[model samples]
Target: MKILVVDDDPNILELVSIQLNQAGYTVQKATNGFQAMELLEEELPDLAIVDVMMPGMDGYTLTRKIRAYADIPVLLLTAKGELEDKEKGFLAGSDDYVVKPFEPKELLYRINAILRRYDKAVDVFIQAGPLKINRQSYEVSVGKKVLLLPLKEFELLSVLASKVNTVFTRDMLIERIWGYDYEGDEQTLNVHIKRVRGKLENLTGEVTIATVRGVGYKLEVASI
Candidate 1:
């Protein structure tokens, strides 16, 4: 998952970025709200960590602006611990508020909590005919048989299964699975797709991954 951290203090930004990166999250840094806005224009992060106080366009304003454009969750990081400040943060569209001088572990806890809530709202079990995918568990099954997939293969399968019958361009899959900054070519994706196909073939013939010629690929389920 990716997280954008917006803070005027260079120290805080570095600290938070380090902590989040250590926790296996992709971290983006912005010195202030304007930078954060620019980054958002490029790509939306899974969540945003914004400081409540900044020079121009404080966290509250940034949060409101983010809410206007995207449903991305925001966690307000500030020194304000009073009830009113937290209320203001929520009013401004922050999903959670954390006072400064926080333990790294506590901050991570809050981040995970917000992400879990967001995932529950957006990610769920997907079913196509006899095939079933549990997003939370990273498990794929066909009827009574469960298939184990590698991380990349599972992610690739998840993306394809998420939208059954909808052709996903190779570029789209690369961006979604490998990330916008992926430096690899289509061959990498093709290899993973081949692996996913091999696994699925072992389970059931009802579900198939179809190549769309020069276009891309799609998950197709045969009518029983």
Candidate 2:
């Protein structure tokens, strides 16, 4: 998971970045809310940690702006520990609040808790026959066995599994999996489909990928 850390203090930014990095998370740093918003526009992070005392674009304002469009969770990290400050942070759409001088373990714990809540709220799993695809972890499982595929292959299977027995056109798949800016041709989609098919075959025969001649592909389940 990626986390954005925004603080005017260089020391706090470095400290928070180190803590998040050591906890197996990718960290993006920003000295102020403007820089953070720029980074957000480039690529949204899973969560954001913002300090409330920045010169311009305070934490509360940034949290409100982020909440207006993105669903990314925000955690206010600041020196203000008063009750009113906590209430204001919550009102600004922050998922949690952490005061300064906090223990590293506590910060990590809160981050994990917020992420867990978000995952449970939005993560969707696709189940086709005996196969289960976990969107969050990108793990495909059948029975008690686990199968991992390359990113593209897994995404292909995921798209097909989303609507079993429904054929998706080659162009649709390409546009959905590879963005519209993709410069590749139909050959790329075919290659990914072939790889996904090979991997699915190793699992139970309950699910299969079917190619619709002159069109695209679909996921077929024996029970359906």
Candidate 2, superposed: residue stretches over 4 Å from native: 126-131, 134-224
lDDT tens per residue, model 1, 81-123: 9999999999999999889999987787777677656755786
Query: Local error of candidate 2 at 109, Å?
Result: 0.3
Look at candidate 2 and tell me the lDDT of residue 223: 76
Output the worst ten-in-a-row residue range by lDDT, candidate 1: 112-121
Positional deviation of 86 in candidate 1, in angstroms?
A: 0.4
TM-score of each: 0.62, 0.60
After superposition on all C-alphas, the RMSD of every candidate to the true structure, in Å, is: 10.1, 13.7
Candidate lDDT scores, in order, read: 0.85, 0.85
* Residue 103 displacement (Å), model 1: 0.5
Worst lDDT run of 10 residues, candidate 2, spans 115-124
Query: Which residue pairs clash within candidate 2?
Result: none
